[model samples]
Target: MTQEEATRLIGGIYDSIFDTITKAAPGGKPLMAPATTVLSLAKPSIAITPKDFRNPWTPGNPTAAGIQPALNTAALVDDAIKLSGLYTQSGVGISEVYGQVMDSVHIKTQAPNPANDKQLDDAFNVLNRKVEQTDPETGEKTTKTVESTLLTDYNTNMIAYNMAQAVYTAAYLEAQKTQTGRATWPMLAPNYQVPVKIAYDKWRSNFADKVEQAQSIMQTSSQNALSKAFKYAKDVFESYGVTLENVDKAMSRKIYRSTLLPSDWYSLT
Candidate 1:
């Protein structure tokens, strides 16, 4: 399928899934309007913030939900480039995913603790170190140093980073099985952004908490298949929108099956 179709399918799924899951709550509402309204990844919404497992006060962590509004909608749109860099867009192996975990751990553990790290550490470091000013009315001269707010990765959290990689790998592998080398994930969509993120965080949590239990919920015949199908989906589409089901149907009705150079167990096309 084309990128637009892929995007739409994911969006529809998000819109539907959120509608369903939120309904189970006492009085949850749709986080975003719909796909048509919030049109592109360039303007995706942070409808629901995932729980930041690592930082507990960052975007990926649900507990840190309050921190998101600091960006506002305009800043959210502006920060797309920085946000996208959180994960490896391309597919990777278990070792790579593990490495991602380690990388995040290292970043979060930075000494002086990250934030623009704005302070010039050099003994002779200076940013307007010598400031001078003259009070015209008082005819007095004064000089002082100006300090700059150090900017570190504002949303730095090892858990979020590693979880992002896990989500990326799952989405990429699923795309490989379902749509060639496509990287058009609904998580990257505007309307579907929240639901997709929630789904990913849930998957990550489930995997972390109870891995063997994945087979029952994911419906994969084998543990390996569960890994390739991108882990956990028991009934995401069946419960909400039929977008995923439709993708499979489209593959079956239109695209002919063929042997792949290096096929994963879950893929036969």
Candidate 2:
């Protein structure tokens, strides 16, 4: 099989599983679109916004229906990458799947604390000292006093605060996951839970045998495609009197060089 064929197969299987799990509501309206347009290691980057982290799972919350499927999509995509051995070969890891998690939910940037900012400002004002400076270019000494330490102190404080804020933001986002799927708990008309649960039970009853088999076929076909491409590229370069050594030099050059190695060429080709 070719790479294109493998990609199509993977997408088809994913669509089948997704559609089964997220069957339409009673009115023939879909709860939401699929989590993604495509499923691939090189899928488009997901944009994570602030709202995702805070959306409530309460009944009638429109956003909640998509959350579980989005998370599951990320997991399945990551599984596909691992099974295909692409992550190992490309230096990409399962962490890429985490992008889907973050994207599916909203996370607000931590708001700056005015009191903390004031305290930091006050501390810097008291601790900062003046220093005498000379012009290095002219080798001329001057009686100029500068608040050099003050700027440095302020920057250091900012860095510390930013790090703390990052930690807080990550924690908040993680907490949101605990509430996933709760939106369907109220069991309103066509509550997503009943159909989704029924579908999942049916799918898992066979241990997801179909998806597993398709993924296995994809892995072999993708690997074979890569090998064929690699040989073609090697042949083209050899015809131009370019050796592997030349390719290595091109890859390693400081300027006008590729960030990829020859192995990466296999995937790109």
Best by lDDT: 2
- Cα lDDT, all candidates: 0.38, 0.44
Candidate 1, which segments miss by more than 4 Å at Cα? 1-124, 148-183, 186-269
Indicate the residue-level lDDT of 1 in model 2: 100
Q: Alpha-carbon error at 53 in model 2, in Å?
A: 44
Candidate 2, residues 1-269, lDDT tens digits: the string is 99999989977876776576566867785545655433233344444443333332222443545344333333333432434312223444344343344334443344576765554554444444455568999987766434444344444554555565565455545545666534433343244334444544544443344334443443444324455455565455334331122246657311111122332222322
Error of 2 at 65 (Å): 46
Where does model 2 exceed 4 Å of error? Answer: 1-147, 180-255, 258-269
> Mind giving the per-residue lDDT tens digits that candidate 1 earns over 1-269?
99999989877875676465334455655455443232223335334332321122223333434333322221322222322312222343333343344344321233452332322232113212456899999989998765321111112333555566666667556666655345455444444345457655654544333322322333433323434443233233223211111345546211111222332322323
**Candidate 1, after superposition: displacement of residue 18 in Å?**
57
